[model samples]
Target: MEFTEYGFPPDYLDEISSAVQKNDIRDLIEEGLIKAKPIKGTSRARARKADAQRAKGRRKGQGSRREAPTRGTPRSTAG
Candidate 1:
């Protein structure tokens, strides 16, 4: 069969035998004929930096307070 018919270049099929079997791709991978690319992991550098800033009291401000200091009570100046 022409290599172009299978979307492969002519030179690419030159190294492989024309009598290649129709085995499953996973079988080829298990037999070490083919390999899959490694998966990438998410980076935590930004998160760690933010945590360090918070630990140093960098992000603590009025907006971060859980409640007001007076708790909505009216203070008497004389008392």
Candidate 2:
């Protein structure tokens, strides 16, 4: 995918563009013109959202809103 296809920071885009003759950042990094910046804990925004979701404990897999009647707990199975 082209870097232009997605939103990239202006400075990052500039570094990527000037890093190598290729438009792809991966290729530039491979060529050693641009060094990949290490991600700080999955990034600021993503980390925030991930931490919030983790605090909420929504992915415990206990149950979902679409609970089905397993063993006749008073449910109509005739659809």
C-alpha TM-score for every candidate = 0.45, 0.22
Per-residue alpha-carbon lDDT of candidate 1 for residues 1-79, written as tens digits (9 for 90 to 100): 2335444446544433442566654454455444454566899999999899999988787676688676545686323
Determine the backbone clash count of candidate 1: 0
lDDT of 2 by residue, 1-79 (tens): 3233334444466665565444566775665545545455744887788779868986545453356536434457544
- The parts of candidate 1 lying over 4 Å away from their true place are 1-22, 63-79
Worst 10 residues of 2 by lDDT: 1-10
Worst 10 residues of 1 by lDDT: 1-10
| Model 1: lDDT of residue 42 | 95
Clashes of each: 0, 0
| Candidate 2, position 25, lDDT | 64
